[model samples]
Target: MKQAVVIGGGVVGCHIALELAERRYEVFLLERHSRLGMDTSTRNSGVLHAGIYYPADSLKARLCVEGNRLSREFFDRTGVQYRPSGKFIIARDRSEISEIEALRDKAIANGAEGISLVPQDTVQKRVPCVRCVGALHSASTCIIDTGDYLTTLKTLLMQRDVHLLYECPALAIDGGVRVETPRGSVDADIVINAAGLYADEVARMTGLDDFTVVPLKGDYYCTTALPLEVPVYPPPNHGHGTLGVHLTPTCGPDVIIGPSETPSRGKDNYDIETPFAVFDDSLRDMIPNYEAIRPSLREGFSGNRPRAFRGGTRCEDFIIMKQPDSVIHLLSIESPGLTSAPAIARFVVKMI
Candidate 1:
């Protein structure tokens, strides 16, 4: 049996550990925190995207599609709460109609189905609160109970008899040589760095150069009311280091207004304080219904996205690079990352 180590206990790390365990590799999962998914994975919008967005050729295009199918199947088998609520990309004005059409074409190119251009008249009758000249409707989209999904993955890992070391943070790494916290060290033939928030530090410790993990905060607001039955999205903001705010409905049927774009200055910045100014100008303005929506009238929270410094990076696919000699690093894994979790894990396991 080959001994391997996976660092980081988030969704990617835990899911990969489960895959490795299935393949009979003696796997040890090391997490700095006491529980799994306690970091960035837990702090995200539980969106199972419909394989829209992104150019057809990218991994975001491929992995997202594969991940969505596989994750949905897994959820069914494991009894995780996942709902295919469907979503719409609304164009509030004629200026966005062209872009919405382009996205429909792109989704087709990416091998996605049921993506159509919805007329403004239909939008007025179906979703009057949301003003739009046109909208892209993708029926393949769904939302998952991310918390329940993570807990299930953790339970699966433990049931497999895989070793899990909680509160055991890695202090240093020289190749496969790692000096973990307390009075201990570990050497293994394989090491995977999926430390969502701190994935950059894990990579640097292995002596690889030329990469940085920029933390982008995505704030969310929640309401008890299932205001709009379908999720509402706007034409994405076409700007560097920026992203547009959208609305999402949770698995429990509550609506979430959110994921505001707030870039982080440094590590350990898990601040959830509401940015009243940004929220007022951007979130409320981009999605007009937010002003009078029932979700806006309820409680909410925020999460962080481990994004690359540039906004273009978010549109790009998740980065999984192996050192060739040894040590594999998964960087800037955000957005559809949760949707791409299983496929990403399988890809990394094969690389190993």
Candidate 2:
């Protein structure tokens, strides 16, 4: 039996462990937390996106579509509660109409389904409470109970006889090196690092060159009511570190908004004021005619997306290492990372 170790109990790590076990590898899922999906994975917008946002041929674009489809299926088989509560890429002003059309065309090229442009009147008819010049209706976008999804994945992996060690951190690791944990040290043939916040630190310990994981703090808001039948997103402003702040109606029925792009020096760094400021700016842009819509002040949470630590470095694909590639590190997995977990797992299995 081949002994493999996966670090992190987030959705990505759990799925990767599940996939590897299916491939006949003895998998061990190592988690620092006592429970799974407690960090970035559980706190995200939970939107299963179509492959519409990224530039053509980007890893984000391809993986997003493939992952979205795989995620939908995984939910059904595992009985994870999720909703195909489609989405609207709202066009707040006249300038956004062209971009909406372009996004629709991009979806076609990327082989995404049920994506099209809708006019202002149609948007108003669909969502009477809010106003828009037009909207990009993504019928494929959906919301899932991410925590439940991860729990189900963990259960399934365990049923398949995969070993999962909670409260275990990969203290130090090198290429094909033994990982010393709180529990003990174990030699691994393959080490999969899906550590969301600490991916860079884990990678560095491996002695690999050419990549770093920078932690980006995104703060989101939760509304008290069911705001929309589906999520309400803004037109993509390419080059922004994030999709502009938007509203997502969670599977739980509470509407969520504002994952404000706030840069930080470390992981899980909490700052309430930054999200508050960005929420105000976002509300002004999307809901200007708003009274009931206010800069939502609530007990919102924050999670750090692990990407490149620098401003200029942009990574658009999954970095899988096995052979000279015996280790795979999933870094800066934010946003669609939740949606892409299932497909990313499959891709890693094939790569090895």
Q: Tens digit of lDDT per residue, candidate 1, span 1-352?
A: 8777788998899889999999998888999988888887777778888778877788888888888888988998999997887778888778888889998989899988678898888766766556677799988888888899989998899899878899988777665644365548767678888888777777778765556677766767666643566778887767633336677778775777777777765556766665666556654544556555533444466567776533333425577887634577888787788888898998898887
Which residue pairs show backbone clashes in model 2?
306-332, 307-332, 321-325, 322-325, 322-326
Question: For candidate 2, lDDT tens digit of each residue in 21-48?
Answer: 8888888888898888888888777888
Cα-based TM-score, every candidate: 0.90, 0.93
Q: TM-score: which candidate is best?
A: 2
- Candidate lDDT (C-alpha), each: 0.76, 0.78
